[model samples]
Target: MAITLSERAADHVARFIEKRGKGVGIRLGVKTSGCSGMAYKLEFADEAAPEDIIFECRGVKVLVDPKSLPYMDGTELDFVREGLNEGFKFKNPNVKDECGCGESFNV
Candidate 1:
């Protein structure tokens, strides 16, 4: 079981951390809300919890809590640009469906 970030995603995150001036890495998690029952949650981590699972990719750290591991295992995160919009995209092997608005997913 593993979660990783694409090189572009890692670079993007690293730049954000540098600009913010304080962060150890980025935390990725899931929350129960949204039309499809689950939505992705992201935040800059200043410190890590004892139970957090950390994966190092492309010279950056991607942190995940133990509870989210099963749902996010084998996920590869990417940062993409489409026309004028750009954001982090999740390539999750466990996702069975996503909401029409693309805000949430169900496995």
Candidate 2:
């Protein structure tokens, strides 16, 4: 029923929004693609649609469409670093399996 972001992810998103100079929040969704059939979609949203379900965490906002909510419920978005590589990671409780390349998942 809800999505949250890690502190690090919030900080990273806030910094990016600040640098970009204009953004309402990050939009999270899922689309049909990749081997597992559903791939995560992310983007900086300058405005929210009327149907979006918004979640606030660490002073940052995440917007999700109602249609995508069921697949992503109880997901926590996080930013992480590993040596020279760093990126956003998803800790999704509903994900029963993920593609080998980590690009897609299925509940």
Clashing residue pairs in candidate 1 (N, C-alpha, C atoms within 3 angstroms): none
Instruction: List runs of model 1 lying over 4 Å from the truth.
Output: none
lDDT to native, each model: 0.93, 0.97
* Tens-digit lDDT string for candidate 1 (1-107): 88999999999999999999999899999999899999999989998899999998988888999988899999999999999999999999999999999999999
* Candidate 2 total steric clashes: 0
Residue 36, candidate 1: alpha-carbon lDDT: 95
TM-score of each: 0.96, 0.98
lDDT, residue 37, model 1: 98
Per-residue lDDT of candidate 2, residues 31-93 (tens digit): 999999899999999999999999999999999999999999999999999999999999999
Highest lDDT model number: 2
> With candidate 1 superimposed using the best TM-score fit, by how many Å does residue 41's alpha carbon deviate from the native?
0.5
Consecutive 10-residue window with the lowest summed lDDT within model 2? 90-99
